[model samples]
Target: MKNESDIISLRLLDQTDVVDDFMEWSLDENVSNFFTRGTFLTKKDAKRYITKFIVTHPWFRAICLNGKPIGYICVSPDVGSDRFKGEIGYVLSSKYWGKGIATKAVKMVAATIFVEWPHLVRLEGMVNIDNIRSQRVLEKAGFTREGVLRKYYIFKRKLSDLVMFSLLSTDQLT
Candidate 1:
């Protein structure tokens, strides 16, 4: 994995990945407000999510700062047309927002994906139109604003339009 900074690392996840802050952020409506999906109903639900699902994804990783998980980053390895293209998503505790944690993590993971998965050429990020902060994160991570996807998702009881951003292996951002 590419280390974004001395304090940040993208580390593999496991079943025992449960953390108190993770559970707390999962239940915080305000914290999850702009997420693409999910607001775990209970602490156990959040824990189960991390253990059973989060740890199983091929491209998922914990966003660690100083050895503590503050968020998660992942690419939907099975969603796109082929293994060469993937959609990415991430979630971080609100306390860490506005600090560039997500931006740095996105860049680090994107770099790793292009290098670690030799066949991969494109990485895409979809941000809810209302989620400007996340859009900025993608922009700062060397992704280009391709176009907007209308009525892209029905997540969390809200149907939303999204902006699509993409990064290609040929682009020189690093």
Candidate 2:
């Protein structure tokens, strides 16, 4: 495990308590905009989906601060192809925005990957073109913007472009 900081602590989403709160987050508009889902429209659905992810994904976390759940951080394999490598996604309580929580959480996860996983050559992230805050967070986490992917993702019913960013294991800034 990496050193725990005063502002954030990351742990696997293995507890029922974390999954329970994850339901509330799923409904919050600000939190769900970037990660849209009709499957988690109800609390029961949210619980089921989150539980499945916790059980299957190796790097899902309940991002907390001051012992309270504030958000989630995930590093998972990209869908469709291996050429894209892996990517990360996160959602934080709006109250925590502008306080550097997302950036800190991402940096911690990135460092953990470099230190613990020998096969990880690189990790990437995709931020919707309109999400400047997320873009800044990725930059602060030591990822460099690669380019834009046309019609990369669909959110809330419309196709959206995304900015791709990545960090290589050899990048000393980490």
Candidate 3:
């Protein structure tokens, strides 16, 4: 575990130990709903996703706290239409919610993207309407809500609106 007080260490996702922890965390319903609509209902499903999302995609990373894989965040270039845009998403274990971990992790990722991937002109997220806590995290990390995407997503077997948000590298300015 890397002990950096106040801020959790963010690193590229790899290693069997972190994968084992991620598999367990992925099955938790509370953690699944906020980011991906509870689509990963079992450990096996999560492993398959981790294999493709984490293993194949070199840009994703495990969000670690005290040497434990508590959640994950990923950034990737937007394919087609908007080649200059990038998308980012994150999810944390239910136990870590309300503790500002997500916000911190997001800021770190944003900083990394702005610095390392300078060509990424826009970074965005589509958040479920009912996810107030997540909205707060995005705001705290400097994302501004752009608009409501009505019936943009289906979660838990029902249609739901999504809040679209983005942060530009220039947003750090006044």
Candidate 4:
């Protein structure tokens, strides 16, 4: 029997078939609770999002299990003088929570991102302080909990504290 990690894979998010799978998590308030964006309300909205953002994103990928997309992961690199660092983010279907799939996907990104972007030295992940599950995902993926950023930025229309985590190019993926 294949374990979750064994079947987990990542791929570009440009395919047409992913729209429905994308909706599974994209529409779930539980999944979008900590995201900067609000939950998508319809397939038309979800498709627009995929076309406008995911398709154009430089480092975004669909998190697949047994060849089906169940979520997504991406690294947004800072431009110009801050180009050495990138912020990593991910979202998985709630059905797969607590199964280590997110950690595996994060580890997969950490293992290859530096190589893919040779200039990148740091991969950062920020989580809402209230989102303990996300914090654990980063920790399990080998990120170091740097510190809390008080009132870091407005999240979902409110000032929110964020826990910052990072994994450097020299760091080993756990």
Candidate 5:
């Protein structure tokens, strides 16, 4: 959990309290645009979806501003032999677009995760090739574009590419 400003804080999600916000975002096509799945139509489905993540995700938090949820961020253990790494993902309501909230949340999550797990040396994030805004957010938070992943994901039955970005523990803030 982190609070960089009086207006914004990241807290472990409370399922009961965040259901509406989660549902609201999950149902919006624009908000879940790049997600291959998760075009839920009802609150029940949204809860079921979020509940699964809450259980499996190593770190999941609600991005709140003025006590209202505006987004979410999470980090899960990475695959392969690299125990010192994690994969990060996030989503922000379109209403909060252009507010720099995503960047702050990323910085907070990255810093807190590094401190919480001293062994972690890298954090990775993948953005759909067309999400220039998201790519900028990662770059602003010190993640470097590693390369393109060709035909990396199947979103809405269409093969799409992604831009992989990574931030190293040794990476200094830009």
Candidate 6:
């Protein structure tokens, strides 16, 4: 029998092909509550967001199961001198939470990101202090908790603390 991790995969987010599936999680308040962006109101808006942001993103992929998008993951590299590091982020449909899909996807990224961007030595993940589930995903994926940044930034109009986590290319992936 195939395990969830065995079937999980990542692929580029297609602007026109997965709008409805994208909206499944993008519009769900439970899924978008901790997201940096607001929930998209319509399919057109979702598609527009996909076209304008996701398609152009340097490293963004749809988290897939059985060849369909169930969530998304991305890594944003800093420009200029800080280009050696990148920040990772991911979101999953609420129905898929607790199934280990997020961790699998993150592990997949950890496994390949260094080769894909050889200059990158570090992959970081910053999670809102309140977002324990996401923090757990990073932990399970072999990220080391670096500590919390107090009053890191404003989230949803309120100042939020963020827990910083990182995995170095030299570190062994879980």
Tell me the lDDT of model 6 at 78. 76
lDDT of 3 by residue, 44-93 (tens): 67667666767898478888887677888888788883557888888888
Candidate 6, residue 137: the lDDT equals: 95
TM-score of 3: 0.85
State which candidate has the highest TM-score.
Answer: 6
RMSD of each: 3.2, 3.7, 3.0, 1.9, 3.0, 1.8
lDDT of 6 at 154: 96
Best-performing candidate as measured by lDDT: 6
Clashing pairs in 5: none
Candidate 1 lDDT by residue in tens digits, 48-76: 87778877777788888887887888988
lDDT for each residue of candidate 6 in 114-148, tens digit (9 for 90 to 100) = 99999999899999999999999999999999999
**Candidate 5: C-alpha lDDT:** 0.82
> How many residue pairs clash per model?
0, 0, 1, 0, 0, 0
lDDT of 5 by residue, 17-82 (tens): 546787666667787786555667876776777678675677888898877887789887876747
Question: What lDDT tens digits, residue by residue, belong to model 4 across residues 17-116?
Answer: 4468888888767898877777778778777887898888889999998888988999998885569999999999888888889998999999999999
Cα lDDT listed for each candidate:
0.80, 0.77, 0.78, 0.87, 0.82, 0.90
Instruction: Point out where model 5 deviates above 4 Å.
Output: 1-6
Order of the predicted models by lDDT, top scorer first: 6, 4, 5, 1, 3, 2
TM-score of each candidate?
0.88, 0.86, 0.85, 0.93, 0.90, 0.94
- 1 versus 4: better lDDT goes to: 4
Candidate 1, poorest ten consecutive residues by summed lDDT = 1-10
Off by over 4 Å in 4: 1-6
Better-scoring candidate (TM-score), 4 or 6: 6
Query: Any idea what lDDT model 4 has?
Result: 0.87
Which runs of model 3 end up more than 4 angstroms from their true locations?
1-7, 18-20, 37-45
Per-residue error for 13 in candidate 5, Å, reads 1.2
Between which residue pairs do clashes occur in model 2? none
